[model samples]
Target chain A: MIDLKRDGDVFVLRFDAGENRFHPDFIDAVGVALDEVERTEGPGALVTVGTGKFYSNGLDLEWLGANRDRFEEYLRTVNALYARFLSLPVPTVAALNGHAFAGGAMLALAHDFAVMRTDRGYFCLPEVDLGMSFTPGMSALIQARLTAPVAHEAMLTGRRYTAAEAQAAGIVARTAAEDQVLPAALELAASLAPKDGKVVGKIRTDMYAGTLAALRGPVF
Target chain B: MIDLKRDGDVFVLRFDAGENRFHPDFIDAVGVALDEVERTEGPGALVTVGTGKFYSNGLDLEWLGANRDRFEEYLRTVNALYARFLSLPVPTVAALNGHAFAGGAMLALAHDFAVMRTDRGYFCLPEVDLGMSFTPGMSALIQARLTAPVAHEAMLTGRRYTAAEAQAAGIVARTAAEDQVLPAALELAASLAPKDGKVVGKIRTDMYAGTLAALRGPVF
Candidate 1:
């Protein structure tokens, strides 16, 4: 289930369901959670994190395998999720307590900042290893968020970056031990909570227009 | 004088003028040098370096003060220079061998990578202290190139960042001693020179669409 709770001016959205794959039900729950946060009166920032050893394993491959006919629609749904997080109206942070792979990695990249657990967890985009290639939207998103050499390595090699490595490579803003990831992310979010959300939103929207356009464009 | 020298697949553009301020003649000379680099066949990358105590002191305030009538046109010229550098059809690296202040800082940020001298000199944006505010275009450019918090501090405080501080704050890609800055930058440029220039150019253009639009828009 997707759980959203408010603590002061920050909202924490936790994916409690195991592995947190993008299944239809999981997507619906996250959408509802996001809507609630967006409509709330006092939230200044949002942080997304997951429980257990897997922050997210990305797309629900099992579900997709069973519903091959819905692949296109599923992709569109995933794109919408990424787009929503990318242009969220307030500051957003990804608290990576566990592994983030493939589309899961993209989700972390969507946020303005990321805090990862240093003792464990790996951030990776394993599309090449899986014999898949990034769509234009995904490619644009990666390029927009990462520097040239880092993006090239991440996309081509499917390397699993440790927290220290990711921080050194500029992937994550900071790192914490396993128990501290969420608090660190919340602290970061809370610090920037006073800025006007609409203004921050507009700046982000304008800053990432090209990537947004590509993400929202036709799926085919 | 602006100098363009081809080092195999990398073209090195050196600003030999003292202080390397943006005088009209200096601008024209740099433009001509850039054209030569653009015209040179098979140049896979570009590295911009300078030969004095200042990589560049930004605008020629002395000239601007004397030629008040040319102020508007002069901004356009400066903007053109920045835009050209921003979308150059090859990979670019800025070798900041000495102080890079104001517009000089912006120029370094436009490049794909920057190597700075760690021993002396500074990287600064002193507009706030100078009783000036950034134009929309300049603001957009800084926002595009830097993280929000870092950009906010640099623009608002007009801090003179030491090389170590600049690297830690993500302003410069790497820092070296005064004698090593150019070589480090050249090494970086040369390493990435095998990549297709057109592809790199396209990626940069799309990634910085918002900033480019503002920089190229009406200069009111």
Candidate 2:
């Protein structure tokens, strides 16, 4: 279940399903949560977190293996979510309570900032290890968010980065103790909640025009 | 004098004029240097550096102040330099030996990486204090390069950042001792020198579309 709770001007979207894989229903639930946040009127911000030991494990590989015919459409939907998060009208943060791997890591990168748990978990892109190539949209999103050296190393090595390493690499804005991740994220979100949505949205849209073009325009 | 020297695979363009302000002739000289680097055919990269106490003090305020009628044309040329540097066909790095102020700081941001002197000097955007507003082009370049919190503080406060602070803020990739700045920049550039120019150029041009649009389109 994806639960969205409101705390003053900030919205917390918590994914409680174990592992929080991007199964079709999980994706749909997130979409609904995003819609609700957008519909609410006021200065606002969002923080996404997951229950237990996994923020997300990325794609529903078993489902994709069984439904090859839907691969293209599925990828398009995933890319759209990344684009949406990248250009969200208000400030957003990914509170990585546990592991964020593959597409999961990509999703976290889409937010304005990311806060990770210091003592446990890893942020990784395992596409190379899985013998898969990144789609153009995925590549663009990562390249846009990271410095050249960091992006090159992460994409090529499939390294599992600890929180301290992620912060040093500029992958995550900050890191906190295991139990403090959500609180840290909420505090960061609240600080930025007073910004006007339209202005922030425009700045982000303009800033990431290239990444958006690749994600939203076509599979190519 | 602006000097272009080739050290193996790296082309170093060092601006030696006092304060290295963007006077008309100085801009012309830099353009000529850029043209020379581009015209040469090789697996190579470019590193821009400066001598003495200032990397660059931005525009020639005295000249611009005296020739107010030519402001529009002058700004066009200045912005074109920025756009040119931003899309340079090979990897580029700026080694800031001293202060990089206003347009100068924007120049450093245009490069693929920047290395600043650790013990002295500062990186600042003083338009707010100078009673001037940034052109859309200038604003877009800074916003595209830095994270939102850093961008907000730097733009609004015109804060002079120390080398340590700049690296921590993600404004520069690295920092070095005064005598080590240029060598560090050259080493960094050399590491990325073998990349195909066309691919790198295309990536940058596409990635920074919004900034290029504002820079190349018009004064508005």
Candidate 3:
């Protein structure tokens, strides 16, 4: 389940379901929440967080196994979500309370900034270890969000990075104690909320035009 | 002038021209040196450097001023060169013995890694200040090479970053005294020389597919 709440100028979207995998219904729910965030008027920003030990575990493999025929369509929908976050009109931050893996980690990267809980969990992309290659869109998003060396090592080695390591690698902007992740994200988002949303969106759109194009392209 | 020399497994290409601006002839000279580097067989890598005061000062404005009709074509050529170095078969390193500004800074970014001279010079992107904008390919290259926030700030603010700041911003891998810049770059390149050039090229091509496409596409 996803919960979207207003805290001052910040829209905090919390992922409450266990693991927070990208199920169709879950994706739809998050999309609706995003629609609401976008409709908000004047001086606003977004912060996404997750409850319990998992921020998000990425794709719903169980659902995918049952709906194999929808694989490409499902990935397309997921990629769209990434593009949306990447070019959102308002500033956005991911408050990583726990593990963010593969697609989940990428979802975090799609944001303007991210704050991770330092005490536990990891940010990892395990596709290489799982005998999978990234979609071109996914590759573009990762490469755009991270520096070349960090992106190279992370993608090729499928490394699991702690909060400190992720910050050092430029994956996350900041790290805080378990209880401070959301607060830190909210504080950062609040400060940025005053920027003109249209200008922010335009800059981000221009800045990530290639990434947006890749994400909007075919999965195959 | 461009000088190419073999230093162990590292090919050291020195941009000896003052300011090392990207004049058409300079571009041609650099291309010739790169051709030699590509022809090298067995273990090999590349280290691009410059003599005193300027690693490179970027575009040859005087030349561009005199030949306005060739602007688009010239940019296309520059973008192609970036694509070439980005996907070079062997590892490449830029040894910034002095200033790297605008397109020159971008050229350094196209390398696999970079070493900066700590005691002198600055890494800068001054287009915004000069009322100019990056070409699409150049934007893609910079965005792909830098972390999102760093890219945003650098491109928008036209910030001049010192070697230490550049390193912290992930613009370069290492920094050394002015006298050691080339040596550091050569050492790093030589260590990576044994990696299968084909594999390295393939991985880089795949990793930067979107960037490569943009670079190889229209200059506009």
Candidate 4:
């Protein structure tokens, strides 16, 4: 369900599964794709996109219901994925084809930049409405990526923001028509692909040290 | 000198010292003013401003040169001040009449919002250029207040941002002509004065628990 392809200097990772939830197998597939991207010799960047109606709908609740015993372990693996994308050696962009909700929206934030399809889709975090509080790591990641006021409003109110609103709120870097979303991300990624990957990674690592520590620490 | 005056529901704290560097006496005076602000009953808010050409220039290096042994203690006090302002029971706004550099810039970030003079001043963090690094608390504060890209650029490059640029980068909530900075800040503060102070404080404290922990922790 995960397709990793090379387009010039950009590695495009496309999620074809319906609703692209974080199933364990899906996570493993993405991890393997990332391993290959990380090993690119020189001048590389990444773009992640999704098929049709959904970019991603966050965690797989159905799977979690069946595997309740692995809750903590599952969350730990998910948090690690966020940290990895946040500190990836190459520039990365998320091209949102449709809805990005909760953990899915966060996955987009973990990337260096994001481009959303303006005509459709939403970026939302509904934990508050669902009677849940964010883990310390998740909170840190959100606060790290967003400006204070935006973070406060989004987290406390669980607002569903459209692409235009998200861009204005500093949540997404750009917005384009549905068909142009991936192309826009690819263009932006290719432009940044020439930067030294190690330096980019090092700078991001230092810049987000607190976030990395929080994500790598205990979930409680 | 620090001047605290009651203007309707808003308390205006004006810093009159030349350069407004954080000397021990200045710190103590500001602390006293803050105590008064905290004691405010009913609807209340705060607006801080500076005289002449400086909002504040940050650390009192000249004073530090003479009291070398107090470096850690002094920084602790400054950090505490930041924490206090960040978690104040009422809404707060900073009116940047002129330059806000290094620690001073951080002071602005601690406020709920800021309004800066649009002409003849700058907002900067020169630590990278000065061969110094941010303490964990300072870094946390900056990251918390800014979007990731803006934080990355500011912390790494030590760029001097004009008021317009600062506003565009989400550094300040608004910008006004030189003569209107304080008025703009007061207007914003006044508008927010009716919010339940306890609720505001509680939400901010919970939202920034990590930042408060870092600020209240050891400087090293």
Candidate 5:
């Protein structure tokens, strides 16, 4: 279950850790959030969270390891779901309840910003360890956003890091006190609410989506 | 005139500076070179260069200063001209001759790899210094390829550096021998020629253009 709750000027969106992740329905939920943000006229912000200790394992490794055919189906669904979150018009912050591994790590990176527990667990895209690479496109996006050295080390080696290290690597915006993580993220969202959402939104949108728009026409 | 010369297992695409530093027709010549590379049927590679000094200051900055009223017209033409260069379906290398400032800097970045001179000048995008930032889209592309510290400093200060530092910062792939820059670039292109272009092309295309095939319909 995903709930969008309003606390003060902030909109807290909570995602429940379920038996199924990245379902077609979940993808639709993300699109709805983006639409709401784009059409909203008031001052508010959105913070995404997950229930309990898992931000999301999407096609849990155990399940995928045992079910290959199902994994492919899940991948297609996961990719579309992630793309919607990336397309959101407003600034987004992902508050990782605990571990965000593999596809989960990719999800966290797609957000405009993220916060996690420094001591509890780890975050990583160990898909390479599982014998694959980031979709070429997503790999390119990571290359653009992070220093090549960091990107190369993470992808090629499939290393995991505690939340503090993720912050140091410039991926995690900040590490929070276990009790303070969501609150910290909510606070950050609240800060952006007063600022001109249009300007902030424009800058973030241009940062992520504007590049492709400019290249729309046939160059050849 | 731009010329393609072969070295040991490498094909170098050298752009010789003509009448106008980055000859107005230079952009077109680049497009033609790319078209040929595409037809070659392998992981395409090419390196750019200028005759003596300066890879290219890009768009004859001085010319633009005098033609402000017609800048819009000039820009539309240049925009159309560079479109093909940006979208070339091959992995290209920028073998910068000398100074690559403004448009010169952009042209260099469009490549998959680049080598710059260590003797003197380096890259800079001083558009913001010109009392306007007309390349909002370009800014996004550049930021993705560069480090935040480097991107922030370059865009905010408009400072230029020696080629040596540019290479270290990953702005330039590597510095080349004064007279052998073209030879070096050609060498790299040829080396990569034997690799499976299918994979390379698939990777590059996916990176630049995602399933962006239909922007209107539900992405899924």
Candidate 6:
């Protein structure tokens, strides 16, 4: 399930994860949050979070592997969700509440900035294990934002990592105490909220465009 | 001219900086190398390098900046090149001969791994400095591969980084004496080759897809 709320100029995007219940489309929920942030909160910044144990665990592999017919739906739904967020005309802060795996990792990357929790939070993407390719859109998104080897290692190994390791790899913006996630994200949102919205939007948009070219270029 | 030669299972894809002049389409030439490698050598790994003191200074700046119309043509051409590399059915290896600036930096990132020279070499994506943003593709490629602040610092500020700093920032795989770049790349390529083409492909592909989802998720 998805939960979107607001405090002043900061819109909060949260998700629910239960025992044996996981879905990929919440990624799209992040898109819905972006819409709400822009339409209701005006052209300002927002924070994305997860309730309870995780930012997300990704494809719900156990269910997906058995119910493979829906894989394309899962992919399209998740892609649309991320597309909405990327297209949002404002800044974003992903407050990773806990471990973000696979699609969860993608959702976190979609934001303008990310603040990860230092508790038990971690990150991983294991899609290659299942024998599919990273969609061109995904490659463009990631290759555009991260470093070469780091990106390569992350993608190739599908290795899991702690928030600390994620930070060292250069993706996580800040590693905060678990209690500090939303507060930190809100603070960041507040700081960015008052900036020149158009300039911020332009920079974000142009930057995204430039890198998309590189990833989608040659052989991907 | 682009040189596509063979050496054992390791094919050599070098930037032919003939008469010290580089076509703006160097990006596509690299794509051709990737295709040749995959077609003749199978779905494994390959290395890309420039023949001179530059992985690439980018656009011959003097030539490209002067020719505005052809510039668009070149841009699209490079996009096709990088896209081809990304979609190549195998992993890639890049050997940065010297500095890889502007578009060159973007190209380096197109590879799955890069061995950049540490001493004289440097890397950057300074398109913004030229009163232009990188095309959408270029920006997205770096975003998906590198971390945000790092990618933006390079893209927005258009700053140049030494090979050492590049390595510290996790840009290049390993920096060596310029003369050693090809050797290091070939050595890595040879070692990377010969693994179960299917298994290694799966490993590398999964390494990229799963790790991306796990570490960052699906957004650019």
- Candidate with maximal TM-score: 1
What's the number of clashes in each of the models? Answer: 0, 0, 0, 0, 6, 78
Tens digits of per-residue lDDT for model 2 on B127-169? 6556465666877889889975577557644679999999989
Best by DockQ: 6
Let me know the TM-score candidate 6 reaches against the reference structure.
0.56
Candidate 1: where is the Cα deviation over 4 Å? A1-78, A84-104, A110-161, A168-214, A218-220, B40-43
Which candidate should be chosen as best, given lDDT against the real structure? 3
Q: B63-165, model 6: which lDDT tens digit per residue?
A: 7757866776766666656555554555567898877887678778867778888667678776777786766666666775666777868778878888788
Candidate 5 per-residue lDDT over residues B97-167, each given as its tens digit? 67888777866765666777777667887877876464444564456457788878877888786788787
lDDT of 1 at A197: 79
Local error of candidate 5 at residue B136 (angstroms)? 2.3
Q: Which ten residues in a row have the lowest lDDT in candidate 3 chain A?
A: A195-204
Evaluate every candidate with DockQ and list the scores: 0.06, 0.11, 0.16, 0.13, 0.10, 0.16
Q: What lDDT tens digits, residue by residue, belong to model 4 across residues A5-115?
A: 999999999998999999999999999999999998988899999999899988888999999999989889889989999889888999999999998999998998899
True C-alpha contacts between chains kept, each model in order: 0.06, 0.06, 0.22, 0.17, 0.14, 0.28
The Cα RMSD of model 5 versus the native structure comes to 9.7
Q: What stretches of model 4 exceed 4 Å from their correct place?
A: B1-149, B152-163, B172-220
True-structure lDDT of candidate 1: 0.85
Is candidate 1 or 3 superior in DockQ? Answer: 3
Docking class of 3: incorrect
- Predicted complex 2: DockQ: 0.11
Indicate whether candidate 1 or candidate 2 has the larger DockQ. Answer: 2
**Cα lDDT for residue A150, candidate 6:** 63
Candidate 5 C-alpha lDDT tens digits along A1-220: 6777778877787877462255556656756766766677777677888876777665455656667767656555565555555655556788887878766777787777889987686777665445454554356446555575456445534568788888877778889977888989988888777766677666665676633332222212
Full-model lDDT for every candidate: 0.85, 0.88, 0.91, 0.90, 0.64, 0.68
| RMSD in Å for model 3 | 7.0
* True lDDT of residue A146, candidate 5: 59
